[model samples]
Target: MNNYNTIVIGGGPAGLACAVKLHKNNVSCLIIEREQYLGGILKQCIHDGFGLQRFKEKLSGPEYAERFVNEVFELNIPFIVNAFVVSIEKKDGYTINVSTVEGIKTYTCENLVLATGCRERTSKQVEIHGSRPKGVYTAGAVQHLVNVDGVIPCKKCVILGSGDIGLIMARRLTLEGVKVEAVYEIMPNPSGLKRNIYQCLVDYDIPLYLSHTVKRTIGYPNLEAVEVMEVDEKLKPIEGTEKIIECDCLIVSVGLIPENELAGRIGVLSDARAKGARCDLDFETNVEHVYTCGNATHVNDLVDYVSESGEVVADAIRDRNDSERKLIDIEVKGRCAYLVPEMIDVNKKNNKRVMYFRSNKILKNATVTMKVDDKEILRRVYANLRPPEMERIVVDYPELSENSKVVFEIEEAK
Candidate 1:
């Protein structure tokens, strides 16, 4: 059994960033990746606009990932690709069982970092009733087919959701000479980034129908058409609003689910709202020494933020000690969708805390307030807030005790 100081799983942007930082700090760490390549989803993301936050330049997905991949290689950081983690055991520290082309191998580490990214929501997950067809695909599947394999899988397509990936594919398919019939979103507003709505859909002259959903897919062996219907505010389809549109493909880009099966297996406490692990200011889960970052923590809007979380994990582990953590709950209320680092570790040396949050619904002139007991600690106002865009903030850790009351609220301004 090979042992190390820390073991970071998933070679995506998060894991790559964590490993690079660990190596720079002279910490022994190893990266285990399931894919043959190390870039994760970025491998097929040929579109530009990534790395603007980290590199201060517009770069393609592969280009941004390549910078970190090159750094990991140049640093000689140990890593194994095409390696899948089968099981994990936590006794004193942690034991990981990985299955690779060679064979099953065991490794041990004092600290574990999960940067497993996320899984795309498929048509089945969204309950789109229809016959099982060949042309129905997730936005990611179509992306890989076109960008990675150079195969145009469809001539005409009806996208079921206005997610970022779906919006991007509308443009991607159009560039490939495939006709994108329209993008149907169940929500009243687009679920993707504002820029994507303009660049991917508006720029391509693609039609976007809000408050609409694909009620059913009509096709034989391959997708031939779909039944789209208007939905009420509650997202229930209207009876007589169904309309048929002929197409060869139905792409679903509803949303992404955090890949947290491993974390669940180990009995880590999860945040229902975040749909991920419940962590503190250090990104350390309820289970001591076990940490999570990136999309594994929550689906992030930007790849740069994912990498930023990896850096947080590295710093957390580097500064970690045997001192007991004083974890206090951060109660979230009001119009916010969710917040990460749900707890505060007042005992940790690092005082600067990074937090991420999203609005539950669209709001203009909204105010966010953070209060400790009856006294307000932080307050910020936003001109506009949308569920599709996540907000990040950095604030100093406030004085906290075991009984200290911490509350975060989002209120819309009149």
Candidate 2:
């Protein structure tokens, strides 16, 4: 049996960030990773684009992860690789039963952080009617094979979603001399960032078929073709709009769902909209001393945002005993899909609070208005808004009164 002040699950960017912050605060912690390596999904993301905001320099995914890994090493944070946490149960007031390889280990900690990250929504989840054939893969799996394992999955491919991973894969495969037949997106607008659309698809001349879907897949023992169809506004297949594209591989990047089985096992309250834990402003879950961040809380597109989430969780844990905490509810409405840190408890002494959220639909030239008890507090406009891309807003404690209800909405500017 091992014990620690804090236990962080998964060695991804979020977990590493949480562990690093705890270490800096002179707190002892342990990180448990299922894989032998600590980098997580970032290891397979070899393309440069990460670290623009966090490091102020563009770096490959591996490079960004290496920077953090170095910090973990320098701090001498203890981590167990290839150790999967099968279950977590709150034992007493401060001890948790963490089932792992060496055996069922009881970890007594002041805080617990869940950074298990997210998993790709697979073709099975989408229920695509087709013969199960070779060469079909999730975008992340293909990324690992190509970028980490250094092997191409196929020569010709068609991506089934316009999410960031699928769009990036289209460009990646194209760069590797593979033919990307097309990227089919059922939504009217691309699910990924506008910048990815311009850089990865438009620049590479890869066609993006919007309001379209794969009606059926055709292949023998191996994937040979796909039947794509244009859809009406209702998303029903239009007659006579079927087109066949020959491809040996099909990559699906439909969406991501938070990996929260462990959190759920311990009966943590979760948000219906975000499919993650319902957290207070301090990133603490309904269970005291247990915190969650990164994709496990909500799917964030940028690694920097994940790191920021980690810092928030750490700060909350560090200040858990503060007596001036007041719980406040943040209501997200009007075209917004979901918001993170679903509830906020203003620490009057701390002076500042941050909120993260995303819109449900695409908006152009719009201003996001936030109000506390019918008084406008903050507003910001963006050239565009999409659900997959997260938007962060910061608010000061003084701007909101104790026990105040904060409301956030988005509207287009004339």
Candidate number of the best TM-score: 1
Give each model a TM-score: 0.98, 0.94
Candidate 2 lDDT by residue in tens digits, 1-414: 367888898899999998999888877888888888898788889889998999999999989989889999998899888677877767754555555666766666667899999999999887577899898899999998888788999999999989999989899989999999899999898899888999999999999999999877898789999889998999888999999999999999899999998889888888888888888877888777789988899888899989888888877676668465566667887778888878765653434667788888888887888777878878888898878788887766444557677888887566
TM-score of 2: 0.94
- When superposed on Cα atoms, how far off is each prediction in RMSD? 1.1, 2.2
Ten residues in a row with the worst lDDT in model 2? 344-353
- For model 2, what is the error of residue 125's alpha carbon versus the real structure, in angstroms, after optimal superposition? 1.9
Q: Residues 1-414, candidate 1: write the lDDT tens digits.
A: 388999999999999999999888888999999999998899999999999988899999999999999999899999999999999999668999999999999999999999999999888788788899889999999999999999999899999899999999999999999999999999899999999999999999999999999998888888889999999989999999989999999999999989999999998887999898889988999888999999999999899999999999998888888988888889999999999889887677536688999999999999998888868877999999999999998866566778888898999887
Q: What is the lDDT of candidate 1?
A: 0.91
Model 1: ten consecutive residues of lowest lDDT: 345-354
Q: Which residue pairs overlap in candidate 2's backbone?
A: none
Which structure among the candidates has the greatest lDDT?
1
Return the number of clashes found in candidate 2.
0
